[model samples]
Target: MIELFGDATGNSIRAAIALEESGLTFEPRKVALARGEHRAAQYLQLNPTGRVPTLVDSDGPGGERLVLTQSNAIMLYIAEKSGTLLPSSAVERARALEWLFFFVTDVIAPNAQAFILSRDSTAAHGDAVRRLKERAFALYEHVDRRLAERPFLAGRVFTLADIAGYTITTASESELRWEALPHVRGWLERVGARPAVERGRRLFRSDA
Candidate 1:
């Protein structure tokens, strides 16, 4: 059995979405970050970094157990295990990976740093936060351009690239200029309408 320990954060949501989309039968174990549950001894044993979205596979390779951290790594692992969420063609897979890293590094990283800066009270980081946010948001135009040429980020079919792009796009929806990014707006709507995406999004909800 697979157990996914996570909260409702973007990284956790991404991992949950990948598991759901991969058609994996997994249990969602919510870690209440608000209550500092992630820092508890039990949880820390699973992930020393005390981060959300840890994956525990009881039936792993060679019939052994596997514990994995890092949201992107977990997503890729799911793809490899399930033989889905990635293109079969090596060329297409490379494109998928390209866009996946684009979202992970170019988009999500800046916004994450901006979020941290915004929360820091030791010094005034408003300007820095603004700059980071601007840098991240501006990259959406590139996504818009890419989407204008194809149905999905990588190509015709949805893959890990879409999964990565969808979560962050959803998180930053309000900040995006929808009117100017018609293609991205359309892509967002299409991806958001997936049933698995819906279920995955609610996996860590308080009511779930």
Candidate 2:
């Protein structure tokens, strides 16, 4: 059996969306961050870093059990296992990786740093946080420009790049200048409309 332990954070949602899109059957285990569940001994045994979005697969390659802690790694594993979420063509596959890392490193990393800084009360990091956020937001303009040239982030087909882009864009929706990014706004609408994406977004809801 495959099990995914996570909350509703962007990283977790990205993994859930990839699993859903790849048609993988896995149990969704919610890790309550507010309750400090992720740091519990049992959970820490599964993830030494005390982070959410850990995946455990009992029937991994050659029947060996697999444990994956990183969200992006889990997405790639799903894609590899299910033979989806990535294009078969070599060039398109490269494009998917390019755009996926573009969002993960360029966009998501800065915002994540800003979030950490905003939560730290021991120091005055307002200017640093603001600068990080500005840098992240400015990168979205490039995503908008790219979307204007193609239907999806990695060209004609939907791939992991779209999953990463969709989750981060959704997380930053209210803060973004949507009116100026028609292409990104439209892409968001399209990606959000997917059944898998919709279900993934709610996988860790209180009611769910």
Q: Pick the candidate with the highest lDDT.
A: 1
Deviation (Å) of 102 in candidate 2: 0.3
Give per-residue CA lDDT, model 1, range 1-208, as digits (tens).
9999999999999999999999989999999999999999999999999999899999988889999999999999999999999999888899999999999999999999999999999999999999998888998888899999889988978899999999999999888888889999999999999999999899999987
Off-target runs (Cα >4 Å) in candidate 1 are: none
For model 2, state the Cα shift of residue 147 in Å. 0.7
Q: How many clashes does the backbone of model 1 have?
A: 0
Q: Which residue pairs of candidate 2 clash? A: none
RMSD of 1: 0.8
Regions more than 4 Å wrong, model 2: none
Cα lDDT tens digits for candidate 2, 131-156: 98888898888888999989899899
Positional deviation of residue 66's Cα in model 2 after best superposition, in angstroms: 0.4
Each prediction's whole-model lDDT (CA): 0.94, 0.93
